[model samples]
Target: MFRGEHIGELVGNPGPARDAFPIEADTYERLDDEFYAGRIETLTASEQDLLLATAACTYPPLETADIRQRSAKSDGNINVLMGRLTEQGVLYRVQKGQYEYTAPKFHEHLIRRTGSLPR
Candidate 1:
């Protein structure tokens, strides 16, 4: 038994497996400020509408149908708009389970521009 224990010690510890969880900050502030400024130039009126709509931040398992019922058209048009805003860094996705909105700047702008009460 002692010799077996020594042999096991020579080898590596065999314990439960361990996994790594990585967190990444995806801010774009490091890029030339001018570049981002130029790229984010005033959003179009249509884009603004879409942003506000998506900024509503619906969760998953809560069908897009529910979102459409609350706001503007929920057709493929809205789907495309959501994808575009997400790509622009205006939106952040939380992949744990539910889909919540993470667009503070965009949401604030929408509120100020429309002077609407929080939903």
Candidate 2:
């Protein structure tokens, strides 16, 4: 899991700065697609539903309680599901009992795939 500080370092420091950074657009896209597919494949039906519900949230980095309510799941179920999602690299802990998607665009991706909007 990437910490906030690590993300800051990546953006703030460009090692061996150059006029133009090399961008392997195709490779990056392929890898991203594969990652998305792989994560999706590992999820159970209920897990997938929970993920979609989380994605539908307008405000993010939600607390466990918020996610549980949104998904209409019990506390214990939400805890387990969140633990699994975090392990799968689909979500990241922002702080204790708070989490957000690992990728900024992941929520949008889920929304598109599930055809679900924030309630």
Candidate 3:
């Protein structure tokens, strides 16, 4: 025969985890601005064009082929750009050969800055 144990004993106190990682309200906006600036600075002209084109679209989770058309980039180049954006957390892969902005607001930000998608 075996004895059962309380879940709390096994898991310990959950409250402590929350306490240890308390949110910092003040730094968030500053940090976000710094991060966005850094990321934009790192992109090449072609990559910036691709990102802006994708961001201008109203529909999301665009297929790789569709994005390639919109961005007017070669298939190989689009693959490379998508891989880099995915690594940077600026894009999210929704499924095989499909992706979308990591956050919709980020797309809106690009649209506001660029005023329109690239031809």
Candidate 4:
């Protein structure tokens, strides 16, 4: 399920990557530069770790256990981190304990962005 009726809002202008299945690098760059950067700007290190953990999932829809396994920072404050991410529109609940990104390809974007970061 997409975020809205018009999918264009998320995947509209292909810019340069052109939606190449696994998602191209340029698309990630453009999306990060234009949209995700603003979204990521306000997150704490733990919250960003949560986002990366969610994106790195093998099957997705990460649960509390999954997050703990994936993130070293998934300590006592995990609930708080997840709650903050939800408040920021970075993630949404799919069920009682499962969560997914608010945007469809955002996880992929996170995965892509990870390779380019300083650490």
Q: Between prediction 1 and prediction 4, which has the larger TM-score?
A: 4
Candidate 3: stretches off by over 4 Å: 1-35, 117-119
| Candidate closest to the true structure, highest TM-score | 4
**Which of candidates 1 and 3 is the stronger one according to lDDT?**
3
Model 1: residues with Cα > 4 Å off, grouped in runs: 1-42, 54-66, 96-105
Off by over 4 Å in 4: 1-25, 116-119
* Reference-based TM-score, model 2: 0.63
Candidate 2 overall lDDT versus native: 0.73
The worst-scoring run of ten residues by lDDT in candidate 1 lies at: 17-26
Tens digit of lDDT per residue, candidate 1, span 1-119?
34555554544543321111111112333232333333345555655576555334443322345446556655777666556655766554454222344432444444444555444
| Cα error of candidate 4 at position 74, Å | 4.8
The candidate scoring highest on lDDT is 2
The lDDT of each candidate is: 0.46, 0.73, 0.68, 0.71
Q: What's the distance in Å from true for residue 30, model 4? A: 1.0
lDDT of 3 by residue, 19-112 (tens): 5444543344454476555666677787777887775565566677767667777889989988888887778889889887765456556655
Q: How well does candidate 2 score on lDDT at residue 45? A: 90
In model 3, the clashing pairs are: none
Q: Estimate each model's TM-score.
A: 0.44, 0.63, 0.59, 0.67
